[model samples]
Target: MSFGFFNIPAPVNEPVKEYRPGSPEREAVKQAIATFRSQEADIPMYIGNEEIRTNQKVRLAPPHDHQHTLGYFHEGTAEHVNKAINAALSAKDAWAALPWEHRANIFLKAADLLAGPYRARINAATMLGQSKNAYQAEIDSACELIDFLRFNAKYMAEIYAQQPNSASGVWNRLEYRPLEGFVFALTPFNFTAIAGNLPAAPAMLGNTIVWKPAYTQVLSANVFMEVLKEAGLPDGVINLIYVDGPVAGDIIFNHADFAGIHFTGSTKVFQTIWGEIGANIHKYKSYPRIVGETGGKDFVLVHETADADEVAVGLVRGAFEYQGQKCSAASRAYIPSNLWSAVESKVKQFLSEVKMGGVEDFTNFVNAVIDERAFKKISAYIDEAKKSDQVEIVAGGNYDGSKGYFIEPTVIKVQDPAYRTMCEEIFGPVLSVYVYEPSYFDSIIKTVDQTSEYALTGSIFAKDRYIIERVSKALENAAGNFYINDKPTGAVVGQQPFGGARASGTNDKAGSALNLYRWLSARTIKETYVPPRHFGYPFLEAE
Candidate 1:
C-alpha cells in the first residue's frame, strides 16, 4: 500500500561556468562541436513513438557559417500535425494517471543529464547552430535549461502540496490535473533553453506536447530531444516536428483537444496566433491556455549622478551582448546632458575594442545576428539612420553578410527622443541613445516611459538614492524587469522570474511556478463525513 506522500528536493539555480580559454568546459564544447560538425544529422518528426519522414526537407546551417550544412530536417504538413495531436490525446490517459512524483523524476533526470554528460554536446550544438559564443551557449543550453528543468520539478511538487483547508466533518482536496488535451510549443531561434523548456515544462505536469522549433534552431532542438529521450521520458509525451507555422496552427488550433500553446517569439506572430485562437474559441473542447513571452524594445536610462564608467559598461554589455538579440537587451538609452560626454566616450571606447565575427573564435565578444532575414532587417534600420540628419552613428555602423550575418555593434545618438529606433523593437546590436537635459530628469523619464510599445526590461543607473526612488516609482509600469545599476539582460531563472506585460505577451513568468500553472487545470473536491437526513437548513427550522 502507498502510505507516504512524496517530496522533491528544493530547487536552486544552476551555476554558469566561465568557459575561459583552455578551460576544461571550453575544451569540451569545442571538441563536441568538431565531433558533431563532421557528421550530418537527419532529424524527423516523432509522433506516437513513430519517426515520420517526409519528402519536404530543410537544411540546418549555422548562422555564423551559413554555407556549412550541419544537417537536414524533414518538414511536417497539416496531416502530420493532426497525427501529433492524436498521439498526445492517445497518450493523455496513462501519462496523467501516473503519479506526480514519477513525472517530476523524469524532468529531474533530464536536468542531471544536461548538467553532466550531455552538457558539452548541447552547448556545442547551440554554439554551432545558433551562432552563440561558448559562454552564451553555456548559459542558454546548459545552465538555464538545467535550472528550468530542476526548478520546475520542485515547483510542481510545491503546487501539488497546496491544499484547501478542511472544515469540521469535511475533507477538502484539490487535484492539479493536466490540461484536458494537447499543448503546442512554438519556440524561438534565440534561446535553446527556451526551446527546450517550452515543451519539457508542460510534460513534467503530465501534459503532452506538439513542439515546433524554429527551422534555424533544429540542430540544437534535435540534441534537446536526445537528452529528453535518454532521460527516460516516455514516447509520445512530446512530439517534435519541423513544420510551417500556418499549417501547424490551422490543424492544432481547430482540434477539439487543443489545450494550450507555449510560445516565445515576435509580437506580430503572437498576435496573429492569438486572434486565430479567439476566432476558433468555440471549436475547442476546453478553453485553451495561452501563455507567451514575445518581443521587447528594452531600454537603459542614465541619470546625471550615475558613474560614467558604470553607465558605459551597462550600455555596452546590455545593448550588444549576444549581438543585442535578447528580448531584454537594451536597444535604447536615455542619458542626461551632465553625464553624456563622459558616458559617450567610455561607450565608444568599449565598442571600438569589442570584436564581432564568427562564434568559433573564443575571444570575439560580439557575434553574428541569427540569419539573413535578421541581418537585412537590422541593416535596413542602419541605412535609414545614415540618411537621416536627425541621428548620428557614433560607433560601429557598418554591416556585411558575405561571410556571416555580421553587423557592427552600432550606437545611434538621436537628436529626437521619439526616433524610430527608440520606439521600434529592432532585435539587433543597434542602440539608439537620446541625450536629455540634466535638469529635465522628470520629463525625460516620462518620455522614456511613453516611447516604447514594449514593457519587457529597462534599467536606471543613478547614485542619488532620492532620484532612484523617484524614477523607480515614476516609471514602474514601463518595464517588467526593472533594474538599478545593472544591465537589463542576463536574468537568472530562480532569482528573477522573467516576462513582461503590454506588448510583451502574457506576463506569466516562465521560470516560476506561475508558468507551470498554465499547463494545469485545478479541481476542488470537498467530502463530508456527516450527512444531514433532511433537506431543511438549521436556520429555516429555527424560524
Candidate 2:
C-alpha cells in the first residue's frame, strides 16, 4: 500500500507532577502503593504470545522495606532465552514491514497511557521495587518515560523523511531500514525511565527486541510491559525474560541472527559482552552493533568565586539523591581552600536535615540502598575511609542493615587527590572531597580530568565568567554532560541529550536522533531517466 507522506505529532516534554501533601496525585500514588502491597502478584516472562511461567519463583521486595513481600516473578532457564530470541526473529519481518506511522502510533498511545491511567501504578512500582522517593519516581517513571516514548516517535518520522537529493533527469531515494536481526535491551535498575527506553527505543525504530531487565527492577518492568501491550504493541515484538547474564549472552552473542544490543549497566559487564561478541564474530551473518552507557565517577568542581551556598546545594542534591546510586551522581568534589569551610558547614547542615527510611514516607529525602550486596559494598568503602588516616569523615558515616539497607550520606575529606575513594566508582551515597589551594585551580582542573577513567557527567560553579569559560574549555572532555552552578544529575530528555564517553559509554546521546540511528540501516536507491550503453563511455570513442 502506498500513500502520501505523513507527520507525527510534535513532542513536548511531559510535565513533572509535584506530589505535595493532600494533592490528588499524592493521594492517588499512596492509594496505588497500598493496593500493590495488599496483593501478591504472580509474574511471567512474555515470550511471543505466551506468558511463560516456570514454577521457579523469585520473591520481590522493596529495597527500603525488605521484610515485606511484594510478589514473585517466575525465573526462566536457558531455554527461555533461546525462545525469546526465536520470538524476536519470527516477528522481525512483519514488524519492520508495517507502515512507519502505525509503529509511531503505538508508542504515541503508550505515552498517553503512561501519562494518564498507568502513571500512578508505574510510579508506585518504582518507589517500592527500586527504592525511589515519590518525587524521584514522578520525574523518572512518569515524566521521563513519557518523554522517551513521545519524542522517539517524532524522531522516527524525522529519520524516515530524510531523503537524498535528486539530480537532473534522475531520481534518488534513501530508505531507512530496520536492522537485519534482533536487538537485545539489557537494562538497569536505577531509573524506570531508562529501563523502559532501552527496549522501547529500538523497537520504535522497527527492530524487534529481547528485553532483560535487572532482577531488582522486575516489578516496574512488568508494569511497563503491560503498558506497551495495552498500547497495541504486537506480541513477540518485545520479549521480556529473566535469566542470568552469562546464560543469555552465551546464546545471544553466538547466534547467527543476533543484530545489536541496547545496554545500560556496569562497565565491566559491557566490556565482557563486547569481548564475547568479538570472539563470536565469525559465527554471525553481520557485525552486531554494541551500544552501552556504563559507570561514572561524576564530580563537582567549586571555584573560590562560586557561591558557597550554591556549591553546597549542588553537592547535596547531586551526590545524595537516589541514595547516590545514579551513574551521573557526583561522587567527588574539588573545593577551593577558601570556600571549603562554608561549603562543608552547609553540606553538613543539609545532611542533618535529611531523613532516611522507606519510600512510603514522603519526608525521607534519603532511602535504602538497593539490597544487601550494594549495602555491603558501599559500607566497605566507608569502613576503609574510617580506617585510613589520609581521609577525614566530615559527616554521616554510620550504616545499619538490621531492618533495611540504610547508609548515611557520608562525606570524606581526602588529603590526597588520588585517594581510593576519589578515583573509584562508588555507586552509593558517599562523596569524597579534596580541597585545593586557590592558586592551584589550574592544576586542580587537570587533576579532575585525570583522576577517573569515567567521563560521564560533572559540573563547575563559579561567579567570574572568564573562569567559567576557562574551566569549561580546560575540562571540555572531562564530562559528557556538563553543568554550570547546577547539580550534575537530573538530565531532561529533549533539553539535554544524555550519555558519556571514555569508559562511561559510547557517547551515543539517548534523547536525540543520534541514538535512534544506531538501530537503523540505510539503503540508497537511484534510477536514471535516460538509459544508454553505460559500459561504453564517451571518452573511449572521442579521444
Residues 1-543, candidate 1, lDDT per residue (tens digit)? 575677788887888899887789888988898987899988888888898889998888887788888888899888888888888888889999988888888889989999999999999888888889988888899999999999999889899999999989999999999999999999998999999999999999999999999988888899889888888888889999888999998888888889999999999999999999999999999999999999999988888889999999999989988899999999999998888899889998998798877877888998889999999999999999999999999998999898888999999999998989999999999999999888888888899889988889999999999988998999888888899999999988888999998899899998899999999999999999988998997688653
- 288-376: candidate 2 lDDT, tens digit per residue: 98999999999999999999999999999999999999999999999999999999999999999999999999999999999999999
487, model 1: CA deviation in Å? 0.5
Model 2, residue 108: distance off in Å is 0.7
Backbone Cα, N, C clashes tallied per candidate = 0, 0
- Candidate 1 has an lDDT of 0.90
Instruction: Please give the range of 10 consecutive residues that has the lowest summed lDDT in model 2.
Output: 534-543
C-alpha root-mean-square deviation, candidate 1: 1.1
Candidate 1 residue pairs that clash: none
Positional deviation of residue 261's Cα in model 2 after best superposition, in angstroms: 0.7
TM-score of 1: 0.98
